[model samples]
Target chain A: MNFLESIKVAVNCILQNKMRSILTMLGIIIGIGSVVAIVSVMQGGQQEMNKTLEKFGTNRLIIQLNWNEWDKITSRDYLTEGDIQAVREMGEDIVAVSPLINYGSTAKVGKEKEDLLIYGVSPEHILIENIEMVKGRFINDDDYKSKRAVIVIDEKLADKLFEEEEAVGKQIVITAGSQNNTVTICGIIKAQDSALGSIMEGNRSTVYMPITTVNKMFYDDYLYAMSVKVADSDKIDEVGQKIIDLLHRRHRNENKYIMQNLTQAIEQVNQFTSTFTLIIAVIAGISLFVGGIGIMNIMLVSVTERTREIGIRKSLGANRNDILIQFLIEAVIISLIGGILGMLLGISVAYMISSLAKWPPVFSIGNIILSFAITTMIGIIFGVYPAYKAAKLDPIEALRFE
Target chain B: MIKTKNLTKIYKNGSIEVKALVDVNLHIENGEFVAIMGPSGSGKSTLMNILGCLDRVTSGSYVLDGVDVSTMGDRELARIRNRKIGFVFQSFNLLPRITALHNVELPMIYSGISARKRRKKAELALEKVGLADRMHHKPNELSGGQRQRVAIARALVNNPAIILADEPTGNLDSHSGEEIMAIFQRLNKEGATIVLVTHERDIALHTRRIISFRDGSLVKDEPVTKPVDAVDMMAKLSDMKDKHNI
Candidate 1:
């Protein structure tokens, strides 16, 4: 019989037992449902993470004193002013370098105190961190050279300290250890808006000031970490190695510093997402296998129940292939219908969770197509044996069966 | 046309063997109506199965429409059954789920006929059996006589070389049985060859030729001097029932 005729026969047979057919498709529905929902949600979260990392700057590298060995560290082992000058003059591929000094301090405008991390940096820090300004301008060369007491606070900190009032050009007194310095805000930068920002840094606000002023006021010109920006991200590892080697020689310490590339962090995040997705996929695959077994069980029962009908069709001139194709198509249609329904269910569930969690819903056609391919293969693989059994039945014996 | 020479069938179950048929020789021309009559296990059913291309013989040759089908494989035999032979079972074997029209269309469907053509041919066949108005009703909605008519239409839809009916009226009342016999006789008179198997002597007397079997062997073969007319039989049956009315 022709394929269309087989499909018609299969559909009629399935319709005759609608409740049983739906029950047989349940396993496949749940399997594909969980797979699509989990994968889409995970992909959305991964994409958000990538965006946050991009905001941190993809071509930037951090070279810092090995903090794990802090007990054995000396002041002389710190990244010095001479080292910064040497890196600045190294090559055209080195875009910018700035020593970063993170000092945990509190700022007060009158009696309104806010917890903050004060980063002491040069004008190059803006380029290395890709800091965006909402108002005013970033620290200039004169601000660093003259050791000016100017600060750049993020919009979130500005909102907390000044609330509806202009924060730029205002003064807030910062207390560090036993000393206090009143600094004028020079600029307001955009606040980090990603959910990851709150997760990684908590609720503490951040502000930036000139490295000269910070060094003169607190650590007395000593620094532990430096941020470096490169012209090309692909050459970041090479440049970071060169800088670390230079810092080692300049400080006369072989194991004093380590280079951490931002690109490597991005790759690590992607690897982690892939591993998580793979683990979930394996669980879904197991469920799909169980569903295929369910299909096989139902198909075997159907063949047995319809033995006499098969005999009738064979007597009417249906060959072995015709009977085989009929049963096989029935199985495939059941799974395929399950696959489509599961896809819609999964997408709806993903969107529901995304709306509640405040993340964008991700929809990929490639993954959808792949789910279809997998379900079809499941149908064929599980359907073959039962169809073969039906095809090989003896017509006379089948006819005689009650 | 049907021809068989030393046709034999053996059924084997593990180490046990039963000879269902032995060296049966028979022939009937293209337009003849023949009856095979026997008791249960008398090899008449086995012989009908072989002739219908539903079973393979253990030895000897059986040819239908000049094709030697005894040595044919399953696929080739199925083709022959589709194109050259039609079967009517005692159960009226109309697929219960489909309408009378679709039941009649089944043989054509297996023969790879198109939908439009199959539908037209099925309608014509159903109309020929006087079931044109009940074409849309399922088998369960039909009476025993109408169901048998539907089966006959299904059998005749493909215009096969021969029609084989195995106890076609066994499940029907006398009135329905006469009606089924009348349809068969009408088709036989229209030049369609037919072979019917039955244990009822009265039913066998309607055919032109009778073949009897006993103990896996053909015991008698003879032409009826005067076959019973199904119309006349039905009229007399109705009069007898009416005269004995309570």
Candidate 2:
């Protein structure tokens, strides 16, 4: 008659066969549980990737020489000092422009000589890439103005060279082309731990020198690539486009260089992660479908088993609505219980996996609510037909059934 | 009051139509105690089913309390059955899992009575049938006689106008069957109309009248000269209990 009484009747019916009810609920539990766990793991992984990407200065725009159409011209031979000045003049929000000239050579500190890449860059290189100084000061404008041969080394490279002794302000010999040069270490950058930060760390091991000195010593006029920093992160794309146009006019060719925005890289990663999450959700949804079928099967069996009970109730004036409500409520209770238990199990598993593997596990309230709604819908959709059949049974025929 | 004119029930099985009730006309007034006696497959059970609203008559005009029940829909028929008639079955049909009290309270539940009031009424019904002490017992825990008593209490819980019983004592021992018949006789004396179906002529002798059926038709309808009073037997038993103190 009332909602509470109907629920009571449904609960009593379920409790009448505890083992059967539990066994039926197990299908739904596994279906919902696996879905939540997989999605959480994927979400955690995406967050971890975003964190790593953020470490590399999401606003930092890389202006590398584009060789997509001009395959004959290499990135290492195309960029020049004149291009850097033209990009700087485009806007005041253009905070820093560091021209890069890279050379692979052997570096000798004391008797330990290691083959490493040497980067000839300006003082603004540290600011643009968001690199942190671990031990000593970064190379300053005074060092670049005087054409000072100063360098910064990562913690790993510093350890290799100094071996427990301080390496700052010490000379390390670099043999590039036919000329051998000795550069003083200005600072030691920290070793990066996360995946994206480690990429910058690997780049940090190079010897840094004044762009003027590199132009004078190496190619007399060449620049390889440039990294730029913008004042406002929101205006990165506009600033990047201005730099590209300025470079195109200065170089007299738009196809020679490419502007790679860090924002686009982050967007790509987001898209990839979202698609992956959707795929996992669809796979998990299949299990819920199977669980729905299982509920239908179990409900059918229940209707058949309780035919006589139906007859007795019908003869006692229980109407079709009563019978339908009773069976439908039984189904919903089973699924709702399974869904709650599944959510707990899934979240716990996701937490455990993330903690054990050191991965980011994302738990969003939206996903939890969506999963719950879907499971309950599955229960109602699957439970209706069997309940209808039970309600429509002929009381005489049902009573006659053994 | 009940009246059926030319009642016919044909059960179709594929291409074959079996006439379960054939051209039966019967009239039962208020507070009448009538027993329908027949052998197996004689359509006495079919007649009981139609009278109980568990089955539809193939062709008939049956009126209960002046309402044309034969043409009513399933839902309306269910309502009528709930408000006006109670049923007792050969198998007892008590929900096995619930206590005797809950089984008796079930019909009142469908009537939308409050739980507290339903419990009180159910207790009174059980006490009326002398099962007050065994209110909490399940069907399995009760003996045959006690189970039938519980069923009778259940039937009386709604205070329906008519009690339709199809072989109510079929599964009981002779003593339990007599005990059940005694309860029925008392219920009849309390002005409830009753129609009982039985193959045993001795069980039929407890009612005021007997209606015999054969080949899906009523063959005879006659009054019994000496009907048994079940409440008198109960009173005599209590008297014997007082006298057997030696």
Candidate 3:
């Protein structure tokens, strides 16, 4: 018989016993569903993490000096003017260094006040931090040289304060404990789509000012942390080590500064996400294996149940090949239908899971096609024995079977 | 036409062997309506199985339509069964899941006939058996006579040259049995060779030839001078039943 005829016969048999066919398909449905759903959720979360990491500028290093309680003398371990000057004079791999002194302050627009992280840095800090301005301009070298009382606030935060007025030329009052001042908004910086505007999260957001103004406002001629930018990304590790050595020489404490390559740390997190996705996929694969066994069991039962039908077809001119094709086609069509249903189920469940976890849903057509191809393979692998048993049946005995 | 020379069939269960058919020689011409009558386990059914190409002969050669049966393989035998011989069974073995028309179309489907041609031929076969109006009904929905007619339609749909019917009327009442016999008679008159197996002498009396078997051997093979008319026999049998009731 031709393929179409065999398919027609197989479809007729499935229809004749609809409940059994559907029950058999349930195993495949759950198997493919769980596998694809877990993969999609992991991929979507990984993408969100990637967006967050991109907010950090390329080839940048952060040096924070908080060496636990072993170095408890704040004056000795903490950063100072000498260490700052030493880092800038280190090596050619180092492009620029910006000493940062942050003061947690509150900024008020009329009566609306919100707490914020107010950073004090040189004009080079804007380039090191990769701040993109949406309005006005970042702190220039002239602003730092003259110690201008000017600031650049996050665009989203400024928009919240002044709904109708443009924020670049506006002025806001700032307070830090007993210290108070007013600074003009020199620029409005746009935040990355999936990141918080400030490095630190709070009620307000980020604001940048000249390093001279912050040191004069709150410090006693010392500093805490600094951000260093590398001229070439490939030499970041070498440059970071040089800066650390320079800081250690100035402070006379080798273990005082903690240097972190933000880019490398982000890559490590990405690696962790991929490993996590693989581990879950293997667990899901076990379920699909069990489901394939379930399909084999049901197909064997169907072959036994339809022995007489096989005999009738044989008597009607069906050779062994024809009978084999009929049973084999029946098994494949069952799993194929189940595979399609599972694809729909998996995609929807992934979407629901991503939404609940506060991430965008990721749909992979390649993964979906792979799901289909795997199920088809499973169908053939599981179907062979049952179809062979049916094909090799003795026609006389089958016909005589009640 | 069918010719068997010293055909024997032995059923073996490990070391023990039982002979179902023993050295039987027989010849049947085309367009002949013949019946083999015997008690149960008398080798008539075994002979029918071999003649229908459903079983193998343990010894000797049987030839149907000029093809040697003993030397043919399973695939060739299956082809012969499909193209040359048709079978009708006692239980009216119509597939219960499908309509009468689809049941009739089963044989034609395996023969590689186009779908439209198969449908047309099935309709014609169903109409020939006077089941045209009931073509869409499942076997379970039809009466015993109608179901047997559907079986007969399936047997002839492939246009096989020889029809082997093993107790075709065994499951039916006299009224339905006579109707089945009438269809066989009409088909035989139209030049289709037929071989029927039955236990009832009354059923055997309607055929033109009678072959009687007992204890794995044929006792007699002879033609009837004048066959009994099935219509007349069925009416008389019903009248006899009525007389006994009174």
**The candidate that achieves the highest lDDT relative to the unseen native structure:** 1
- lDDT, candidate 1, residue A331? 89
Q: What share of the true interface contacts does candidate 2 keep?
A: 0.63
Give residue B86's error in model 2 in angstroms.
1.1
Q: On a 0 to 100 scale, what is the lDDT of residue B123 in model 3? A: 98
Worst lDDT run of 10 residues, candidate 3 chain A, spans A195-204
Error of 1 at A151 (Å): 6.3
- Candidate 3 displacement at residue A124 in angstroms: 2.8
The best candidate by TM-score is 3
Which candidate, 1 or 3, has the higher lDDT? Answer: 1
Candidate 3, A208-302: lDDT as tens digits: 89888776667546777888888898888878877877777777776777777766766786788778777766766676677677778887988
TM-score of chain B of 3: 0.95
Model 1 over residues A1-402: C-alpha lDDT tens digits?
A: 888887888888888889998888888988898889888887788777776777777789888999888898998898888899999998998989999888888899998998888889999898888689999989999999999999999998899899999999999999978888899999999987765654555556878999899888786768788988999988999999999898888878888888887578768877988888888888888989999999999999999999999999999999999999999998898889889888888999998888776666677999999999999999999999999999999998988889
Q: Number of clashing pairs, model 3?
A: 0
Cα lDDT tens digits for candidate 2, A189-209: 876556444354453455556
TM-score between model 3 and native: 0.89
